[model samples]
Target: MTSEVTIRSIQAADTYPLRHAVLWPQESIDYVKLNQDEQGHHYGAFCNGKLVSVISLFIDGNVARFRKFATRPDCQGQGIGSQLLRRVLEEAREKGAQRIWCDARAVNENFYRAFGLEPEGNRFYRGTIPYVRMAKSL
Candidate 1:
């Protein structure tokens, strides 16, 4: 079935449940909470009125970084995450952000590459999960 999906700014609290569900199910919900959340702009994708995808953008002058991006497991491969990323990128550019970056899970490198985000350093591990620093010029 087709559902209407809308992307919009959201409060930090709105992202915690989905982040915990999709990105850190084995850990407590607090595992998904970031100290910088209060200083960032959060965005969510709502599908048929339910929040299904979330991303946070933290800006520092002309540079911006996104963290804790996650989409519900059932919603993966449906392009909802990509739509949310694109919207945030546009918003960042409009706000005069010159660079946007993220520490992306290594497994998802190709997905970020499709959006022009290039890896800048060697892979690193956060606990047991591998990640790479990826960035794009806005």
Candidate 2:
């Protein structure tokens, strides 16, 4: 894949395939859809004209939460997700969010920490998968 990545706002529907492929392959496609999708802001990262990463941000009051962050398996470790994350974090700050968080998969806690988000509370599970709430003040 080319190293050139473009990050931009996208419709929530555009995030489903990647969300399903990378985050919930065993679930039905409908399981990947968020009920409040129309109320959130979605973004995608494209490399060489192919979508490679996706994240959704929901801002409420002074808080913002990002969800369903995923990168194509083949595109992992290429920094594309990093760029997309930076974009949404910046977007959150610009939109007046004072704190941003996510229910990050436990295995990726270190990855989120590298971006300055700290784990909060005890670890929890969604189905059989473990997760932790990570957050940072913007």
Candidate 3:
């Protein structure tokens, strides 16, 4: 595995394919209806030019709302997601975000906890998929 991982802004071409690999087939996101430009800030982790992980941030007032954080299944546990997360947070802070937030899958709550995110709101369902809204002060 190449350890030359890179995090950078997402191109539109990367959005659809990654959305399928990450969010589709789970009855969660309606990827076919998504418009990346209107959605949020998108970032990707590239290993030797291959996209292995992806995350997004949407700025609203003093907060940066995270969206569609995903690492390719083959890349999980190798810190690709962590790299993506850290870069997103750094970008958020640079943009003057006072807080950062995301709605995480219940099963992956521990991952967010590692970054200091805590459940700060009620659970929400997107087609029966459970998510907990988490927030962290930046």
TM-score of each: 0.97, 0.98, 0.88
**What lDDT does each candidate get?**
0.94, 0.96, 0.82
Which lDDT tens digits does candidate 1 get at residues 103-127? 9999999999999999998999989
Query: Per-residue lDDT tens digits of candidate 2, residues 100-130?
Result: 9999999999999999999999999989999
Off by over 4 Å in 2: none
lDDT score, candidate 1: 0.94
The 10 consecutive residues of candidate 1 with the worst lDDT sum are 1-10
lDDT value for model 3: 0.82
Superposed model 3: Cα runs more than 4 Å off: 26-36
Number of the top-ranking candidate, with lDDT as the measure = 2
lDDT of 2 at 88: 98
**Residue range with the least summed lDDT across 10 consecutive positions in model 2:** 1-10
